[model samples]
Target: MLGDRLGEITGSVTYQRVLRDDDGMKLETSFQATGTFLGVSVSDVGTYVTVLRPDGTQYSEGRGIMTTEDGRTATWTGHGLGRSDHAGAASHRGSLCYQTMPDEWARLADVLVLFEYGVGADGATTSEYWEWK
Candidate 1:
């Protein structure tokens, strides 16, 4: 993740697949962030563990899988937390679709985009776009 000095945030992320069972797949990710935001040395840390099915459906925090009319597509109920300057907890909920790409290249492209957008520079945004060769 990378941001501006006004809130400059930059970091590297590492993800590990920890468990795969009949229930689903579990991913553990760690992020190291360091930067300046709000005139303060912004240093934060956190981790996320997501359980997703082979079809890309996630099950956690009241989110689950829902099928479309044709049954060819699956959608997930989404939820997350918001970062705040004050110490508190925030929550979010939304819906997302599951898509299957044709090849590994496509899959990799999608992952790269996600990382970039997740950590791209945006005022008040904690994440910024990342690119890899």
Candidate 2:
């Protein structure tokens, strides 16, 4: 079941590159974001690779680290399947698993997070996360 909304972030894509282009196109992208999680303010940096098939469908896998104002950190990994629109926008719904440094934020280590991620045609990004209970 989906629990409470945990956080939301808005950012921009910082880097992108085409990694391959034979049978399918493989692209890599990195982003920077800032938001709040469990009432704590944080910033995030992540990189993901997406494989775009000939049919306009895509699969993505990514890992990222979130750090608090005081330097506590958590790492997460996730994957999703999505499709690119004709206008170049893409959206994905996925799940994430987190590992937190032993601290007050350790409770997140036991939580499952679900996310919705979107990229606009202009390279803007937005993400929202919820707890999966």
Candidate 3:
């Protein structure tokens, strides 16, 4: 079994764009983050999209795949609840759970992860993640 500190992923926003619609423009952000998993460095590239509804609520969806340095890979999804600040940066609180991985990395299948996601007015983004025992 993997311990509490299964690993950490640290990356940056690779790109971000806005799509305008009737309600408002949707936000799309992509990032490349890397972390240590199972004693090896792993990398992930994923995207998060958010839409502000007419009722003043926010909906978000995210998906990403992780690849270990040696070639094993696994997929993860981020489902969250969010709201925008007065300045328009989205503040989100959510959990990220993952699918199965290869035999060598299968321990990740039972881990629990929670995170705080923040997108600043200047387009800078930061995330803090924790693994629950």
Best by lDDT: 2
| Residue-wise C-alpha lDDT for candidate 3, range 16-132, written one tens digit per residue | 898788758687888887777656788878898888776766787899888988788888898777898789777787777888676875555776677777767766666666665
lDDT: worst 10-residue window of model 3: 1-10
Which structure among the candidates has the greatest TM-score? 2
**How many residue pairs clash in each candidate at the backbone level?**
11, 0, 0
The CA lDDT of each predicted structure is: 0.35, 0.87, 0.75
| lDDT-better candidate, 2 vs 3 | 2
Model 3, stretches more than 4 Å misplaced?
Answer: 1-3, 20-24, 53-57, 84-90, 110-112, 119-128, 131-133
Kindly report which residue stretches of model 1 are placed more than 4 angstroms away from their true locations once superposed: 1-8, 53-133
TM-score per candidate, in order?
0.36, 0.91, 0.69
Clashing pairs in 3: none
Error of 2 at 53 (Å): 2.2
Look at candidate 2 and give me any clashing residue pairs: none
- Rank ordering of all candidates by lDDT, starting from the highest: 2, 3, 1
**How does residue 15 of candidate 1 score in lDDT?**
38
